[model samples]
Target chain A: MTIAMTTSPEALTACCTPTGEPAMSEETASSLAAQFKAIADPNRLRMVSIISSSENAEACVCDITEPLNLGQSTVSHHLKILVDAGVLTREKRGVWAYYSLVPGALDSLAGALTGRS
Target chain B: MTIAMTTSPEALTACCTPTGEPAMSEETASSLAAQFKAIADPNRLRMVSIISSSENAEACVCDITEPLNLGQSTVSHHLKILVDAGVLTREKRGVWAYYSLVPGALDSLAGALTGRS
Candidate 1:
């Protein structure tokens, strides 16, 4: 529910600058932190991996919950966190919500790790 | 005191895998989380910025504390965390300890964020 559209790499770059730079602006820190917070938890991190490695780099909540050995609602909550972080994309298909990687979102974050991007 | 030698990028790369590929191994998660946890604090994040943007990509604790408006002990603690996380390198110079960016540590973390190495 607290998600916004991070529609481009520039937006992500602008919002999530290098720590080697001037740290990051407060808003940028908060936004980038939100994305990191999504993965801060071990459960959510695992969920992201499972979801990404799924068929076509995406998976539905139903498929995600099984390998996780967690409750359905718990899986849904984690999925929402990833979607909100701009790390994953979610689409509604008939009666299910399908989730996939946000193309370069992870790559952008990876770029921060490499100091490029 | 809880830190170990993270001497190379291969170590960093092998240690910190892509979150999307799979949740990082537990050991990798703990190590990478230690780095993120270092920056999780607002004060530390700010301090890192000031230190990183300083001359020579490094700064002494003496220069770092003033701009932060924080206690000297607090600054020292944060510096230790960054050093331990492998994000910043430390060297003893006479009576002072000089800290500098650990080359690609942040880049590696940024890699995690962007989903690359």
Candidate 2:
């Protein structure tokens, strides 16, 4: 595989320096883009800040709506996006559902942005 | 201000625990969301990977289009978005423009996401 790659004329291109950094695949880009898109909204980011900074880095949907002055349904929509993106996890306790950071999600994304990945 | 905050019942809310983490403001969220939104597309992300992994973490408009099989105009559009968001900066020399990450831009965004900011 290395021999085959080294033979390609593209190997000589500036994009393919021997930095051991492979260009991101379309798949990787799509997945990461989805995560980034999920948090690309201002209100959604506020939701993340509120939840991540909450006690135990988690909070209930009911408690989340008021501080941000958002309605229940709107907060839920943002929370759902974060959960789907793997940035947050949800747990149900009796009548209330709580949300918290998925742990290291942002750090990994940070690594990707700086090419540390 | 400290006394005023201590007396508010909302301060007692779980969203406002004593962790010293302030929820992201509308302005901060809007600015960050723009940066995140710029990179939220797959093609844009691939462009970022190609440039970031390049030698010295920078690349030219000419060299960038080929790796992703994108036309000049599309790549230019993506580059403009990145530049406008302050994630990447563009410098023109002679006939070519080179782009590089705004130093610590992604790190700071990462910090914002993890509430480290």
Candidate 3:
């Protein structure tokens, strides 16, 4: 339910302020960049899309790898990067790891870029 | 006011559908990834932030570099990437090159990720 990014508290706080308000501090830009970087790969982008579209807006590694035709390790790798970026949350249920979008994470990122904040 | 990404029409069409709708084809994912890759760097994100927050929601390279403490060449490099990705529009006003967000570009990207479509 709760996912945390590796970005520092200060950077995270500064990451999604509406554009044109002020120049972002270097730390803030770097933090935001990291989030973008996580989804910059085609495989990762597809993984996010697949998980987001799943029932209950969540999917396990098993579900993702099949549709993506990617190996489990590869899917897991992408999932880890997303989780580290705070874009996705990982929950362990029995032998499976289920990934879900962190509420508002993408919205805030989008809001930051689109001046929607 | 019109900015074009290097992404093909098919990819563009596929880029912004709601995430839960279906798995993105490889081309769509790649196109979306290219857009994300353009903004994946700290400097680029700041450049976008600076431009988005400016008067009329636009900024020139000169205006952007000064605030970021970067050189003209460095700033230009980042701008070109954004333009190529179709995230920003480049306009030549006399000798200065002005950059503005491509209308709805960020919104579409955000919509894809956040299920806002």
How well does each candidate reproduce the native contacts, as fnat?
A: 0.28, 0.59, 0.58
lDDT at residue A85 of model 3 (Cα atoms): 97
- TM-scores of the candidates are 0.66, 0.81, 0.79
Candidate 2: clashing pairs of residues: none
Per-prediction DockQ comes to 0.14, 0.33, 0.25
Question: Model 3's lDDT to the true fold?
Answer: 0.81
| TM-score top scorer | 2
Query: In terms of lDDT, which candidate is strongest?
Result: 3
lDDT of 2 at B85: 89
lDDT (CA) for every model shown?
0.66, 0.80, 0.81
Cα RMSD to native, each candidate? 18.2, 8.8, 17.0
- Of 1 and 3, the candidate ranking higher by TM-score: 3
Docking class of 3: acceptable
The sequence of per-residue lDDT tens digits that candidate 3 reaches over residues A35-95 is: 9999999999888888777777888776787778888898898899999999999997545
Q: Cα RMSD (Å) between model 2 and the true structure? A: 8.8
Question: Highest DockQ among the candidates is held by which one?
Answer: 2
Alpha-carbon error at A29 in model 1, in Å? Answer: 2.6
As a TM-score, model 3 comes out at 0.79
Better of 1 and 3 by lDDT: 3
Chain B TM-score, one value per candidate, order as shown: 0.74, 0.78, 0.79
Q: What tens digits encode model 1's per-residue C-alpha lDDT throughout A16-115?
A: 2233444446665566556666676666666666766665777767566655568989888888877887988889754567788888777765543343
